[model samples]
Target: MKNDYLFKGEDICKSFGSTQALKNVTITISRGEIHGLIGENGSGKSTFSSICAGIQKADSGKLYLDGKEYIPSGTVDAMDKGVSMVVQEQGTVGKISASANIFFGKEAMFVKGGVLNVRKMNQEASRVLNDMGITHIDPQVMIDTLTFEDRKLIELARALYTSPKLWIVDETTTALTVNGRDILYSLMNRIKEEGGSVLFISHDIDEIMNMCDALTILRDGVMTATLEKSEFEEDKIKQLMIGREMSGHYYREDTEESIGEEVVLEAQNITGGVLKNVSVSLHRGEILGVGGLSDCGMHDLGRVMFGLTKPDIGKVQKGKGEKVKNAKWAVEHGIAYISKNRDREAMMTLCGIKDNICLPSLKQLAKGGFILKKSERNLSSKWAENMEVKANSVEQFCNTLSGGNKQKVVLAKWLAKGSDIMIMDCPTRGIDIGTKASIYQLIEQLKKEGKSILLISEELPELIGMSDRIVILKDGVLSGEFYRSEGLTEAKLIQKMI
Candidate 1:
């Protein structure tokens, strides 16, 4: 690759209502390079990228693109000037079709006077979909009809259509399956081959280490260090970003703990949309990990167990009680479900943190049909503190928090309810290292307290590390079962997953 400078940022600064988001961060990229950006949540990585991509303005910074002073008014202007970003959060409209979402903000291009040319828009969108090897998604189907993974793929297609000189991808792989990731890897390689640049962001250290030629570390909005591929160290990179030594116990090192004999929860011959005669048991004190590829029906198992979906044949029983028939019954019977889609399923985005946290336990917090506000606030505050939720107050809206903070709020809400059985699905999907460590510790602590947990995850290492017992699901059935032994490995679990 040529050593020509592709872009540069000088003294980038930004703030939000007296809170400095980025503190004079600066970095550069060269042609045909995939530069990795890493930082903890609230560390200003997203802020810096948003500024560079023109989604937000920098308070005091100068940027140069191709040796010219680059200034963009908005997202469209930024894309017009050859820069595009796939934001970390969801960026598609549910009510619109996939094709319409792909061509969003540029729909005017297909307008003839006042009339929109639907035929031309669909045709172009179809061509792009074909190019991306996305044959399962219909361009005319509403995005709401698609799954979260498919919708993320649609967003990727939207960015690809821009053909920008610089692509800013922020924590996108967490939403994709293995095949989708391979597609993205190929796309990034193709961009580098064509003399374009990519600024990739992710919480997966291994991904950043393998895919990026150079790495830029950010700590609380400050540029800590930048390292070449030859200089990369897993522990050192994390140390620089968090400004401390993270204990090497990345997972729970304890293997002596064994689960109790009593069965706390059981799925007995449960048959559902994706599950067929699925039977599993969660002991009194155990972290039962369920592992598989994204489409292997493992996630559906969690939903059915939580009563989000009723089985076509059998029942989900809890603690010597009647079968749990619905979500309300499940919650009332001390079962909690932390859904993978937090924004839509877990959090009431428009409500206060206290309201969301106390939502499940309101009946217990009531007196003579009158809701006790004081009790609500106290309970929410207690668990919020326990989870180390970073919010100004319990009155703060859950929607306004960062991704990691949001996940904490969800976990806290469930933990506050004192659920005996918890179904955690991808609990730390896109969060950073420090938060991940805390969550792992929390799971371990909960197990010690005899709170049974069903951890359904796409991450194999997490399954092998955190689980007391793991079951691999393939095509909605049990493929393999493993216990927490020194002999257990990710390769063994993966062998069953496929």
Candidate 2:
């Protein structure tokens, strides 16, 4: 039976400083099946996966691959051992061609006589990308020029280039659109058909149930339960993952539109990127959802509203028609942006939580041209506690925190700033159901407090469940608008999105 397993870990224990991230955890994956690994933030899912992928070493553990002791020195070594992982955050480097990103560390393969064959590398990159059903991205173009979803696909191409026996996808589908997700699902199914295995990690229980043959649930670094497909139950799985029972829907209970007539933020014929002459308005007390496919201009609209990116034509106006000039000006005038690209745009990974949460509110925390440490600490601590950010302390670096916690820190910073208008792009992406529920509740509370929110999301269900009014964009244009009602369904939104 041990020989039947493709990979196995026994008594895995890992710690960072005094924090026990993984505690005597054990798991197994057999050949030719996709296995699900799920847990709340900081529950040791990514920690355990990192150990297997050679990105991190376990403090104490024994790992067996194909019935042999497996110890990988690093990611390259793990690749050599038939293992590769697509990380949670952005893994591709900018200012480089897509082909270079795909063959990043393995450039030696394309070097002949100490000279790199760029064309061969590009050809192989293109082949791998097309093999994985990613056809639109150009291999020769700068990676930064592509959309976030395209870059994610390039990282997937990089992982599949080696044809590893075991592939690990870490919260990757959250970044993708429907088409990109379909491509990934096809690849996972194909791998299983080819007698290979996949370690699929996600915060979405429904996705895990539908995609995996079996799943292991973790809670605070402990393996609470392992359930087969036949034993899969949403409520049971949610309880196991969070160490508590969950009931009812996390979304808003109201079905009627409730909002003020005053426009807090309005985009006046904004045009840039994929957007073309798009205009929209967010009310004073409204969760105005912006939804579309990935390539639609919804994300650009969020950036424009926050003044992070200026529109080529037209302008975004605040209360009483004050034009948003730049991000600094927007922040100064009580506007906050929670970017969909959280790791890159919303956080400084090397900075501590205190710095991250106190950054946007520095002006408020300062007096007599000097900022007091106590003031900063008080502000950061209050918001961090409010957001329930999990860290050893506020001094812990952002990079060391889990995905959901990192997002919490981002939110904490903006909340501490006390902004009245927030442009949130995929705010709950890659977050667990428990945290998502809390965020939904928070959004509703913010609306009650008369804060306007521009909610941009690829999840149609989210828009229908949370928004006072929903706007659908297609090919960079406003295609449809619908008010909150029981008739609002994903099918109705999809009709506009496509």
Error of 1 at 176 (Å): 0.4
- Give per-model TM-scores: 0.95, 0.97
lDDT of 2 at 26: 86
* lDDT for position 88 in model 1: 61
- Model 2's number of clashes is 0
lDDT of 1 by residue, 231-302 (tens): 999999989989999856789887754889999889999888878888999999989999887877889999
**Residue 310, model 2: Cα distance from true site in angstroms:** 1.8
Reference-based lDDT, residue 11, model 2: 89
Off by over 4 Å in 2: 1-3
lDDT of each: 0.88, 0.91
What C-alpha lDDT does candidate 1 achieve relative to the native structure?
0.88
lDDT at 122, model 2: 91
